[model samples]
Target: MNSKWLWPSIIAVLLIAIWLYLPPGIDPVAVPADSDSIARGEYLVKAGGCISCHEGSEGEGGLSGSAAVESPFGTFYASNITPDPETGIGNWSGEDFIAALRHGRRPDGSFYYPAFPYRAYKGLSEEEILDIAAYLQSQPAISHSVAPHELPAWVGRWQMLGWNLLADWKEPGREMNDDPEIARGEHLVRNLGHCSECHSPRDALGIIQYRDEFKGGEIPDGHVEAIDAEALNSWTEEDLALFFLIGMKQDGEFVGGKMEPVIEHNTSQLTDADREAMAAFFKRGLPASP
Candidate 1:
């Protein structure tokens, strides 16, 4: 046996075996098709901040996917999430929708750019994901074709595989010892709200740095920095809740810039209890300033 040929053949066989065993996208499942399911989806959409990106700010376009989100890589135009058969997700199956949210893959199996924030969304339960999908399907079908991302040639769908390798893709679970309020906050902040996706700094590879988690970082496009999570310690729970509810500080300073839409579309829609839970969680984690 020739040593060089033997090693090359063995490596080729191993690579082939690995490819064959790779899991395919999850099979399609039948989601609930009822008004109650759609209503639940609507609530989850707001909680998840879907409109903040899909639809431009209040004065801009509607949820027709006309928004262009700026990022370190380039400008990524949000896709049409409306139920338009031609340009939106109207034709997508339940599994197609779930795959995009949980695995960041399109119906054709192409990867979505991390700009979609699907990493945090991956923590959602299948029921929740399907509910959101059902709600999207109920929306008026708007025909809109988003512009392609302005990325470098080397940046492609395949690159997401490497990114996923380093990401926390597991679903979030409950802690038996966690306080109820704190637990609710953890779910909102870490899973549904995905607050750290923006507030934490990312490395050159665009991965969030866990060591600096919740410590302030620059927003995409380098225009503004996200407030550090610890900074909330300086604010009273009432103030924090007010900020989430209305984007206003106790000092009468209004939240402007990118956060305004988030407040208007997402946080503001949360129930008072949810806001209180978030406040309690933050206060419990960070010490109040002396």
Candidate 2:
């Protein structure tokens, strides 16, 4: 070996070692067939935007994921998550589900691309995860096969090893609001809602910038406005809550674009109280502007 290049080669080997070795938890259990748990799971799934991301185009597919997401990296297709024995998660145990949600690892022990948004979901409680699993299990099995992600030719699943190593996440806003409802809303926004995933901008590696969270930025299509108190000050919390259900603004303009599905499937489905909580959560710290 050439003496001059020896050090570089050693460093490259070490980097590979780190990536491979770090190739990275949850109880393996069956979901209860009870309706209550399943119901809760259904709600959580909606809150988590499972349908928005996994639902087939125009509601034709039910968690038969193939929803295309355009990003800088490439167009990634969501995978089927229905209870199909062959094509879906029918074989996945509760632990596999938990691992996928909390740790971003597939049942095969491979790293899932961050497009799955497991980083934000890591905060979910074990019971919440179980409920989600229950809800998914109850859905009718669909043997829909999904297309593989069309990321750049240079991008590969194996490359995720290196990508995961550099993962860092900051809480969006940890200020303890005295109001329990507001706190719950925060939990939903940060975790179940995964609101920051879209509303916030990302670094070069496509990680959400929690510190600048709700201070929206650009997406593949266009820019998302900041949703912080200052930005939404003109609207009362009541109006905000109503917006979640109706997707209409006080200005009479309806929310469209990427948020259409989110409103139609996720936030619009929330209970009134939960919607109020979310509205209060977003509008916290500022009184409605006169």
Candidate 3:
């Protein structure tokens, strides 16, 4: 038997498969010059909390993507997301943007570190993804070049394939009987808001454990712990809605730490009905604390 070539043949096949799975590159699309697209994108950007990691503050350099995101692995610098042709996503095609957001694959077919939260973003609809892209394109281009991520030698793009294989890549299926409010809450919480990404405990591979969904876990900094979503179930809907609206807990203490920015940039911007829906959804779905 020709056992000598067997290993080589297997390696070649695996390489070819990986290549086939790589996202294809496309030419950059022309940015839409309309106000409606920009407005929709603005709403989605806030809903997705893009500003928290990308902008840092309200003044200049918004979406320049220079913010530092610390993780258990290393410090990952957010890329320049502004429309700068040289340093940002200005020249990215709609497909290129979508590939990055939905598949975590760069236009050059490299994997983005999971710190970017593409796993949660993969659940977003195509229209929403495009709208976000359009909004980014409409922004004034910034020329900030971010430093590369400081990662361990073992952490590489190839590992992303294995991660995706093990992770829940598919969006959860919608139930036929889901009311509009429930559906909206589910979409906001699971996809755009991505609350569970922080709230759920993760395995060694940095994948969120479904068993611990919204049950609380250590944040990336290794010091602060995320509050369990189920814990919020004790609060009345009015209290929950008010908390989201004003960043004040039912106990009269102001929300602080990482959650402060989330409320400021994301939840505070949400509509009253949306906040109420989220409160109702959390109360109904999250398990009661023991």
Indicate which candidate wins on TM-score.
3
Whole-model lDDT, candidate 3? 0.79
- Model 1, 1-290: lDDT tens per residue? 78879999999988975563354558769766799999999999999999888994344355777687777777788888888888888898888878888878888877789889888888788999999988989888877777888887877877677677766533233453258887777667777888878888888888888666677667654534444455664677788888899999867999898889899999999999999888777777533334
Q: What tens digits encode model 3's per-residue C-alpha lDDT throughout 26-143?
A: 4455545578878888999999988888883335467887677777888898888988999898888888878888889887888888888898898897778888988998888978
TM-scores of the candidates in the order shown: 0.87, 0.87, 0.88
Better of 2 and 3 by TM-score: 3
Pairs that clash in candidate 3:
none
Superior by TM-score: candidate 1 or candidate 3 = 3
Show model 3 residue runs off by greater than 4 Å.
Answer: 1-5, 8-16, 24-31, 56-60, 169-177, 220-229, 287-290
RMSD of each: 3.5, 3.7, 3.0
Q: lDDT of all predictions, in order shown?
A: 0.79, 0.83, 0.79
Worst 10-residue lDDT window for candidate 1 reads: 168-177
- Tell me which of candidates 1 and 3 scores higher on lDDT: 3
